[model samples]
Structures are given as structure tokens and as C-alpha cells.
Target: MIDRAIKLWFFSALVWLVIGPAIGAFQSLQFIAPDWMNFLSAIALPYSKLRIVHTNTVILGWIVMTFISAALFMVPRLCNTPLRFPQLAYAAGWIWNAALVLDLVLIWAAIPDSFWLSIQAGEYAEAPLLVDVMIVAAVVCVIASLHLTVFARERPHLYVSVWYLLGGLYTTAITYLVGNFLVLAFSGEGYQVIEAWWLHNAVGMIITPLGLGTAYYIVPLAAQQPLYSHRLSIVGFWTLMAFYPGTGLHHFLQMPVPIWINEFAVISSVLLGIPVLAVVTNFLATPRGNWSRAFDSYPLRFAALGTLYYLATCLQGPFQATAAVNWYVHFTEWVQAHAHLALAGAFTCYGMAAGYYMFPRITGRQLYSRGLASVTFWCMVIFFPIFYIGFTWSGVATGASINLMGNTIYQTINITWIPRLSRTITGTVVVVGFIAYVWLLLRSLRVGAPYESGMNEVPEMGIETPFEEARA
Candidate 1:
């Protein structure tokens, strides 16, 4: 039952990975040529509506669904117990997917003449009231399923992965409800404050916790080692919960909000480095003696590199949150680049690594081609830096032209055209890697090598002892 549920969630996530990024690429093309995708407007859709669809679909549909599948697979195994409610898990997947579809429909179908189905204008919480209700129901099902599984654990001690999974599940439910519903209680300037809070926490609370948690689980396994420091893992988890929630306020520093709010957000954003360092150090240290394996294993490479990207994203985030830096980079391509670094670079890498590691295990089949996987990895490694650097440089140029030279917005856009065009080129190249990845997953499902159970375990590494003993 658990195996069936894992496959369902994972394949569903893959479907979204294909759909979400394709929407994103189209949106990118629209930026390069605004008049190109006019057919979309026939359905009463514009770039503004499609933007939220792309964002929500990738974040919720691809990243969240993939990580939830990982948690479903890992939690029961780590706890040495069966999943407590397999039916609920399965049902939640369908409901979640249905809600996402409804969300897109609401966005695309909305018109001035038919405003009933229109989404709220909130940044991340743009789903209509009906879709929001469905989301809440789906989240409830997920929480109940996971919490019951945790309660039924046969292992006396809970693993750090388990803590992350359970904590992320409940906190995300709270974050979703508050962001989508509670913020509606405020209007005027207060609404902006609450909205900014919701926007940042939507990523910080939901995606960051799940992404880091999945990394913690997958990294050591791919490296064929126990974690370097369990104590560090604990500290990382608590500090993350402590610092991430309030850091959302940094998004509104340029606004007329309270000064203390901005200061606290800056402090929290900077202090976020502690947990990031703790987790990255643990991952890097785990593969000390098995660095060769780390390179040879595609999943380890993804997880390890994802950790580094996570570090880069966090460090840049704090720098951008500072007053002087924020004044320049805010509302520019720099923020977009930073967002992709976290979402596309760090979390997507983790999700892809999870898929690479778990797909074969769940399906009892090998990946179709390691060479293809390597191609995908290298394509991303090459093109993402290209994408990031181009966008960052363009933004800095735009900011400097406007701030230092006192140029108008029109002049800034013209000054940044070359780098902007470079970004479009590199972004298109990155999509090729995405296509290769999706192809790998689909092909492996059909013709990959037969997988023998337990082949992932390494006795010499001493990694299987604790879990095996717990099961016994």
C-alpha cells in the first residue's frame, strides 16, 4: 500500500514538473516578446494570471508534491513501521491534484464579466475561495496520514528526517491557512504587511523545510554513510523553525512598515546562515571517505550540489535583505535570479535527486541511462550559472543606471537589453535539461534494468545497521 502510494505521488509530481516549467518557459518567452502569446488572451488570461499559475504549479505541484512523496517513502522506512493510513495518502494525492487543476482553471477562466471564479489578487495565495477550501481539505488529509504514521513508529527514537517531515507538514498547513485566509482579515497598509509576510513564509516555511528535510534524508543514503553529526541536525531543525517565520518581513523593508519589523527581519535573515551552514556542513562531511562514490552516484551529486546552491541562495538572501543592497536589487531582475536560485536551483535539484534515488527503488527498475542523467545534471550546472549571472548582471546594471546615473525606467531597460537577452538564451537552454530529465523518468519506467531489492544497502559503510536492527 505504501509502495503504491509512493509511486502515485511521485509520478503525479513528474507530470506537474513537465507542465509547470513549460508554462514558465512560455511566460519567459512572453517577456522576450510580449505580443507573441496572444492566443492565451483569448481565454481571458494574461501574463499576470499565468505568472501565478506557473509559480503555484512549480512550487506546489512539482516541489511540494515530490517532497511529500519522498516523506511518504522515507517516514515509514525510517520509523520501522507501515504507513498508518495508506488510503488517506492516496486520496490526498488526487484531491491535491484536482485542487491545482481547479486553480489554473479559475485563473484562466476569470473575466471582468464573470468575476465569480476569479482568484484573489494575493501573491502566492491567488487560488479562489473554492480552491482554497479544497487545498485545506487536502492538507488535512496529509497531516492526518503523516501524524498517524509517526505515532505508530516501532522505532523507539525518531530520526531527524521524521522530525522535519512532521514539523513541516503541520507548520505548512498553518502557513497555508494563515496566508490564504487570515491575511484577508486586514486591508489597507496592514494588508500589505500581512501579504508580504505570507509571500515570504510561503517559500521559507513550506518549501525550505521540506527541501532541507529531503536533502538530509537523501544525502547520507547516497553517500552511503550515517550523518556526520546528529546533534547538528537537531540544532539545524530548531534554529530553522526559530528564524524562518519572522524573516518574511524583510520583503517589505522599503515600505512604510514599522522600523523594528524591518530590523528583526534583517537579523533573522542573516542568522538564517547558521542553520544553512549546519546542514551543508553535515552533508559535506558525511561523504568524507566515499568522495568517489559521491561523484559516481548521480543522486549524491544532485544532493551535494543542491546543498551548495542552498548555501549560495541563503547567503545572497541576507545580503539582499540589507537596506543598502535591498534599495538597489529590489524590483529588479536580481530578485528573480535569487528566487530561481532557491526554487529552481536548490529545491528542484533536491526533488530531482529524490526522484533519481527513489524511483528505481519503488518501481524495481534501474534508470534508463546514467549518461543521460549526467547530461541533464551538467546542462543545469552550466546553464543555471549562466542564467543567474546574466540576470544578476542585468539587474545590477539597471539598478546602477537608475540610482547612480539617475536614469529613467526606459533608459534602464534599454541599458540592460543585452544581458536580458542573454538571460532568455540561457533560460531556454536550461529547459532542454528539464526535457532530458523528464524523458529519463518516463523511459526508465518502461525499459530500465530490473532492480533487485535491498541493492542500495551498504554493509561495509555501517549505514544499514541501525535501521535493520530497529526492524528486527
Candidate 2:
């Protein structure tokens, strides 16, 4: 039952991996030539709506599905027990996908806001009241399933990955409700404050911990190493929960919010480095003796790349949140680029790592072709940064010309033509990688090489996983 359940969510995540990014690539074309996407407008696929769809699908759809699949696979193994209720896990995945479809369909419908509907308020929180209710139901089911799995544990010790994932899921529920429902209770300035909080934390609290938690499990396994320091893992986990929630308002520093709010957000953003460093250092150091394996293992390489992207994101996030930097970069694509670094850049890589590692195990077969996987991986290594650079370059260039030089929009528009073209081209290239990845998965299922079942065997790592060490 659990096997069937894991496969359901895993394949669903692969489906979204292709879809969500394809929408984004199409949207990028609009910037390259405003009329390029005019046809999409005929079906109400205009850039405004499509942008919201792309973000929600990728984050709530793709990343959320991937991590849930990861947790379903990992929890029972770490707990030394089968999932408490496998059917609930299976039902939750389907429910989550149903909610996603409703969410996307309603977005395309462009439903108007009403007392009951709450069509669109914040960036990713744009789902209508109906969609929000469905999503909250799905999240609740997931939370219950995971906790029940932990409760049924035959092993006494819990792994750090479990800690991060369970804690992350709880926060996901809290932030989602607060951002989507609680804000409805307020208006005027308070509403904007809630929007800003949800906007940033939608990534910070939701994606950051979940992605990092997936990384914590995958990195050591692919490298065939014991966790470097349980002590550091604990610090990273605690500090993250402490500092991340308040930092959400940092996204709104330019607005006329309270000075105290600004100062608090800035302080919280800066303090995030403590957990960020601890986490990154732990992953990087874990592979010290087995660096060669990363080159050989697709999972490790993607995980390693994810760690680097995460480091770059956290370092840049706080720096930009500062008054000196946000004042400048906020005007440009810098914030958008930073977002991609976390969601599209880092977490996507982590999702890929999870899929690449788990798929072979799930199916009891070796991957069909490492060569095909290489095509996807290299595309990521080469084109992702190109896309990110072109994106960041376009924004910074536009911001400086308009904000710094005091040039009008007309003059700056002329200057931005080439950079926008570059952004579109590189973005399309990144999407090609996504397509290749999905194709590889489909093809592997049909022709993957035969392999022995590790499902019944002891874990290859041989280290203790009854729980995370240095127990709280």
C-alpha cells in the first residue's frame, strides 16, 4: 500500500516538473516581444494570470508534491515501521492534485474577489477561497499522516531530516492559513503587511526548510556517509524556525510600514545566516571523503548543486533585504532572480535529486540510461546560470537606468531590449532541460535495466537511523 502511495505522488510531481516551467517559459516570451503571447490572451492566459499560475504550480504543485513523496518514502524507513495509514497518504496526494487543478482552473477563470471567494490577494496565495479550503484539507491530511507514521515508529531515535520535515510541514500549515485566511480579517495597511509576510514566507518557511530537509537525507545517502554533525543540524533547525518567520516583512521595506517592523525584519533576515551556514557547511562537509561519488551519482551532483544555489540565495537574500541594497535591487529583477534561485534554482535541483535517487529504488530497476540523464543534468549546469544571469542583468540594468540615472521609462525601455531578449532565450533553454528530464523518467520506466531489490535489504549506509542523534 505504501509503495503504491509513494509512486502516485512521485509520478504526479514529475508531471508538474514539465508543466509548471513550460508555463514560465511561455510567459518569458511576452517580455521578449509583447505581442508574442497575445494569442494566449484569447483564452485568458494573459501574463498577469499565467504568472500567478506558474508560481503556484511550481511551488505548491511541483515542489510540494516532490517533498511529500520524499517524506512518505523516508519516514517509514527512518521510523522502522510502515506508514500508519497508507490509504490516507494515497488519498492526500490525489486530493492535493485535485486542489491544484481547481486552483489553476479558477486562476484562468479570473474569478472576481467577493466576501466568500477571496479570489486573489497575495502572490502565490492567489487561489480562491474554495481552492484554499481544499488545499488546507490536503495539507492537514499530510500532516496527520506524517505524524502518525512517526508515532508508530519502531525505532526510538528520529533523524534530523524527520525533524526538519515534520517541523516544516507544521509551519507550512500555519503560514498558509495566516497568509491566506487570516489576512481577510484586516484591511488597509494591515492587509499589505500580511501580504508581504505571506509573500516572502511562502518561500522562506515553506520551500527553504522542506527543500533543505530533502537535501539532508539525500546528501549523506548518495555520498555514503554518516551525518557530519547532529549538533550542527539541531542548531540549524532551531535557528531557522526562530529567525525565518519574522523576516517575511523584509520584502516590504520600501513601503510606508512602521519603522519598528522594518528594523525587526532586517534583523531577522540577517540572523538567518546562522542556520544557512550551519546547514550548508554540514552538507558540503558530509561529502568530503566521497567527492568522487558526486561526479558518478546524478543524485549527489544535483544535491551538491542545490546546496550551492541555496548558499547563494540565503547570502543574497539578507544582503538585499538591507536598506542599502533593497533600495536599489528592489527596482530591478534582483528579487525575482533571488526567488528563482531558491525555488526554481535550488529547490528544483533538490527535487531532482530526490526523484533521481528514489525512482530507481521505487521501481526496482536501474535507470535506463545515464547518458540521457546527463543531457538533462548538463543542461541544468550550463543553462540555469545563464538564465539567472540574463534575468538578473536585465533587472539591474533597468533599475540603474531608471532609478539611479533618473531616466524615464521610455528611455530605459529602449535600453532593456537586448537583456529581455537574453532572458527569454535563456529561460527557454532552461525549460528544455525540464522537458528532457520528464522524458527521461517516462522512457526509463519502459526500458530501465533490471536491478535487485534493496527494499528488503539493510540500508547501504549501515549507520544508525533509529533517530537523529543528540536527541532533543
Candidate 3:
């Protein structure tokens, strides 16, 4: 039953992966040609609505669901127990996916005149009130199921992965409720401040913890080693909980909110590097002397690269959060690039790594093709960097033109046209790569090489040697 739930969540996430990036590619085209989507205007699917759809679909539908699947799989294994309430877990998956679909429909149904049906315009909390309620309920069910599993653990000691996963689950439920409802209940000049907190926590609290938890579990396993430092892991986890919740204020530093709040946010944002370094150090050190194994293993390769991207995203985040830097890049394409770095670059990579690692184990089938997996990895590695570089270049050029040369938005657009065009091209490469990835996943489900049962030998370097065993 738990295996079925994992497959459902994982495959559903891949389906959203296809949908979200297609919308993102269309959004990039809109940047180049504002009227490109004009034909769809008759149906009220404007850029704003589609933008929300893209963000929500990728974040909640793809990244969140995928990580949840990882949690469902990893938590039980770590605890040495069966998943409690398998039926509830399955129901939660359906409810979560349904809420995402309903949220998108509500966004589309909100014609210009029918504004009431539109979702709340919060950054990460854009679901309609009803959709929000449904999501909260789904999360509640997930928490209950997972917690029950944790309580039934046969393992005497809770592993580090268990700490991160259980803590993340509890925090996510509270974070969602507070961001979607509690914050909205208040009204004042400080509303924007409150909203910023919610927006920041949505990413920092929910996605970051979940992504890190998945990585922590996969990294040592892929490398065939114990964690580099258990103390560092604990420190990293606690520091993340302490610092991440307050760092949202940096997003609104240029606003009229209190200056001290912004300063604290900046301090917290910069200090976040501590936890990032600790976690990265632990994972990187664990792969020592076994790096070549990663080259041969697709899951290890993905996990390794994901950690690198995670490091880059964290470093870039602190630099951008500084006041002087924020003044120039806050409203520019730089911020968009940064967002992609975190969501698409960092967490998406982790989620995919987890999927690749677990799918074969859960389904008892080898992947369809190593060559195809390599292609998918190269596409992401080559194209996503190009995509981010083009966008960052466009942002810097546009910002310089506006601040230094006194250019209008029209002039900046014309000046940055080359990078914008490159962004669209590279984004298309990413979308195609993702499509192929999804195809590979689905094909493997039906026709991949079958796993031989009762082969329990731990090969050298902790690699799965059977597929290569036959090839050799």
C-alpha cells in the first residue's frame, strides 16, 4: 500500500513537472513578445494568471509532492517500521493533487470581471480560500500518518534523516496554516511585513527542510558511507530552524517597513551560510574516495550535482539580500534567476535524484537506459546554467541601463533583447530535457529490465552492480 502511494505521488509529480516548465517557457516567450499569448486572452488566461499557475504547479505540484513522496519512503525505512495509515497516505496524495488542479482552474475561471473566484495574490500562497483549506487538510492527514509511523518505530535511535523529515513535516503544517490564513487575518501598514514573512517561510521552512532531508538520506547511501559528522548535521538542522524563519524580511527591505526588521533579516540571511556550509561539507566529505562511483551511478551523479547547485543558491542568496545589492537587483531579472536557482536548480535536482534512486528499488525494475539518464543529466547541467546566466546578464544590463544610464523600460528591453532571447532558447532545452525524463520514467515503469530477487550482496563502493554486472 505504501509502495503504491509512493508511485502515485512520484508519477503525479512528474506529470506536473511537464506542465509547469511548459508554462514557464511560454512565460519566457511572453517576455520576448508580449502579445505571444494574446490569442488566449479571450479565455482570461493572461500572463499574471499563467505565471501564478506556473509557480504554483512547479512548487506545490512538482517539488513539494516529490519531496513528500521521498519522505513517505525514507521515513519508514529509517524507522524500521511499516508506514502507518497507508490508506490515509493514499488519500492525502489524491487530495493534494486535486487541490493543485482546482487552484489552477480557479485562476483560469477568474475572468477580468469575476475577481472573487481568483486566488489570493500572496507570493507562495496563491490558492483560493477553499483550495487553501483543502491543502491544509491534506497536510494534516500527511502529518498524522507520518507521525504515527514515527511513533511506531522499531529503531531505538532516530537517524538524522528522521529528525529533518519529522521536523519538516510539523513545520510545514504550521507554516502553511500561518501563511495562508493567520497572517491574512490581520490588517494594517504592517500587512506587507506579515506577508513577506509568510512568503519567505513558504520556501525556507517548507521546501528547504524537505529538500535537505531527502539529500541527507540519499547522499550517504549513494556514496556507500556513513554521514561525515552527526554533530554537524544536528547543528545544521537547528540553525536552519532558528534562522530561516526570520529571513523573509529581506525580501521587502526596500519597502516602508521598520529598518531594524530589515537589518535583522539581512543578518539572518547572511548567517544562513553557516548551516549551508555545514550541510554541504558533511555531504561532500562523505563522497571522498568514491567520486568515481558517482560517475557510473545516475542517482549519485544527480545527488552530487544537486548539492553543488544547493551551495551556489545559498551563496547567491546572501549576496543578493544585502541592502545595496537588493536595491539594484530586487525587482530585476536577477531575482527571477535566483528563484530558479533555488527551486528549479537546487530542490528540483534533489527531488529527481530521489526519484531515480527510489523508483527502481520500489518497483523492482532497472531503469530503461543509462544513456538516456546521462542525456537528461547533461541537459540540465548545461542548459540550466545557460538559462540562469542569460537571465542574470539581462537583469544586470537592464539595471545598469536604468540606474546608471537613465533608460526607460522600453529601452532596457531593447538593450537586453539578446540575453532575453538566449533565456528563451535555454529554457526550451530544459523543457525538452524534462519531457524526455518523464518519458524515461513512464517507459521504465512498463518495459524496463526486471530485477532479480534475493540478490542482497553489497557491492564495492555501495554501487548497484547487477545492471553493469550483466553488461560486463
Candidate 4:
């Protein structure tokens, strides 16, 4: 029964995964050729609005849903108990998904006379206040279900993964409230400050911990290894909770908030290195003797590559957060590239690894084809670096032209256009990888190998997991 709810949440994430990236590809086209949007004048979405939808759909719709699914999967296993009210969990997932669909309808259809009527003012907070309330209600229900599940736990001790997942959900509710509601309630400088806090906390508080929590569980389970250090995991968790809130103001350094806020943000952003290092060390260290197995296991591959991307993101984050570096690179294409390295490169892989790792366990079927999984992995592994490098290259050129060479934003176009074009083409290939992932997931339900009595393992997993041994 709990598995049924997990499946619903997972599939919901998959649906949005395909939709978000597909829209993102088209949004990239608006950069190369703004006039191309004229064809969609029926929808009447400008590039800015199109961009908002793309970002929110990916962050809110896809990644956030994936995190919820992760929690649903993790909480039960960690607690050693079935979900307390599986129907409520299932229904909450459906309601939240419906809210997301309504958001898409409201944004794309343009039924409302004013933009604010369709959505809200903030970037990721653009989902209308109504949608936010609906989602908050849905999440509260899910949280209640999850808490009841935890409270009924047979396990005597909680694992670090449980700590992170449940903690993340609570933080998500509060941060979502602050980002969507409190940010809207105030005006003037107060509004700007809270908006800035919400912007960074939306990712740092909500998505980061959830993504990390999922990775912590999936990586060790898929690799069949103990976490590098339980103490380090707790260290990462607490340091993250402490340091992340102050990190938001770093992004809005140019705003005239306060000199002290700038100093606090930079300091905290640098302090963020503590958790980042602890996490990267733990993730990377666990697969020490098993690197060779990664090539054969698609889940392992996703986990491995995801960790590498995490390391890159953490290293880059602290460096770029410095006041000196933030000046020229603030909103440059480099920032865009950096953001994708975390969300697309790292957390997306974590979500994929979780989905692939758990798909068989939940459904009692093997993957349809390791061959297709390879295609999906390699497509992402091949094209994403091309996309990232091309993007960062353009950003560097753009930054130099404007900050160093005294060129206008328009003046940098000739220098940056080629790389931007490369970004579009390569990014589409990466999107193709995600499409293949969704296709393989859909195909597995019909044609994937099914388990029967006395089967040694799920045919897809070459490793012997505890679940497999239990099945045996």
C-alpha cells in the first residue's frame, strides 16, 4: 500500500521532469532568436515569463516532487514500518500534483487580465498565492502522514538519512511560507531583504538538504557500503542548518540593504564550505574500492557522477560567493552555469539514481533494459559538460567584456553568441537523455522482467543487496 503511494509520487516527478526540461529547451531558443517566440503568440508568453515557468517547473515541480518521493521512500525503510496512512500520502501527492498542473494552466493560459493574477511577484515564488496555499495544505497532510509513520516506528534508532529527509520537510514548510507569504506581506527594503533570503533559502534550505538526504541513502545502498562516517553526516546536517540562512544575501550584494548584511552573507557563504566539504568527503569516500563496478551499474554510475558534480558545485560555490568574485560574476552566464552544475548535474542525478535504484524494489520488476539506461547515462555524461563548459565560456567572455573591458551588455553579444549557441545545442542533447530516462521508466512497467519465487535478485541489479537477499 505504501509502495503504491511512492509510485504515484515518483511518476508525478517524472511527468514534470519531462515537461520542465522540454520547456527549458524552448526557452533557450528565445535567447538565440527572440522573434521565434512570435510563433507562440497565441500563448503570448514573453521570454521573461517563459523563463519563470521554466525555472519554477524544474525547481518546484520536478525537483521538489522528486525530493518528496525520496522522503516517502526513505521514511518507511528507515522507520521499519509501513506508512501510517498510505491513502492520505497517496491523496496528498495527487493534490500537490494537481496544484502544480493548475499553476501551469494559470501561467500558460493567461486567462487573468493582470500578470499578478496569474502568478506572484518573486522568481520561484511566482506560483500564485492560491497555489501556494493549496500546496502548503497538501504538504502539511503529507507531513502528518509521514510523522505518523515515524511515530509508529519499530526501529529503535533513526538513521542520518531519516534525520535529513524529515528535517528538510519541516524546513521546507517554514521556508516556503516565508518565501511566498512573508515576502509578499512587507514592502520597501524589508521586502527586498526577505525576498533575497527566500531566494537562496528556497534552494539552500529546501532543495539542498532533500537532495543531499536522498543521495546519502541511495549512494550507500546502491554501492552496498557503509556511510563513510555517521558523525560527518550529522556534522554536515547541523552546519548546513546554521550557515545556509545567512548565505542568501550574497546573491543580492548590489542591493543597498546594509554593509553588515553583506559581510554576514559573505561570511556565512564561506562558512558553508564546512558542510560542503564534509558532504563531498563522505560521498566520495564511500565508493573507494568499488569504482570499477560503476561502469556496469547504471545506478552506481549516476551516483558516482552526481558526487563529482557535487564536489565541483561546492568548491565553486564558496569561491564565487566571496565579495571580490561576486562583483563581476554576480549575474553573469557563469552564475547560470554554476546553478545548473548543482541542480541539473548533481541533484538531478541523485533523483535518477534514487528512481532507478528503487524502481525494482517498489514494483517487483527489473529494469526493461540496461542498454537504454546506458544510453541515458552516457547522453547526459557526454553532453552536459559540453553544455556547462560552453555556458561558462560565454559567461567569462560576457563578464570580461562588461566589467573588465567597459563594453555594454549589447556589446558583448558578438563575443558570447557562439558559446550561447553551443549551450543551446548541447543542452538539447542533455534533455534528450532525460527523455530517454522517462521512456525507459514507462517501458519498464510493461516489458521489464518480473520477479518470481526463488529469484536470486532483480535481474537489473548486478550487486547483491539486503533487499535481494531478503527476497531470496
The whole-model lDDT of each prediction reads 0.83, 0.84, 0.84, 0.82
Clashes of each: 0, 6, 0, 0
Q: How good is model 2 by TM-score?
A: 0.95
lDDT of 2 by residue, 302-364 (tens): 999888999999998989999988888875787898888888889999999999988888887
Candidate 4's C-alpha lDDT? Answer: 0.82
lDDT of 3 by residue, 152-239 (tens): 9886556677788879888888898888788767777566887888888888899999999888888878777757776788789999
Which stretches of candidate 3 lie above 4 Å from their native place? Answer: 111-117, 452-472
RMSD of each: 2.7, 2.5, 5.0, 4.1
Model 3 clash pairs? none
Better of 1 and 2 by TM-score: 2
Q: Which candidate is the best by TM-score?
A: 2
- Which 10 successive residues of model 2 have the least lDDT summed? 455-464
Each candidate structure's TM-score, on Cα atoms with residue i matched to residue i, is 0.94, 0.95, 0.94, 0.93
What C-alpha lDDT, on a 0 to 100 scale, does residue 284 get in candidate 1? Answer: 90
- What digit string (tens of lDDT, one per residue) describes model 4 on residues 119-145? 777767888877888888878877888
Alpha carbon deviation, residue 9, candidate 3 (Å): 1.0
Task: Give Cα distance to truth, residue 419, candidate 4, Å.
Answer: 0.8
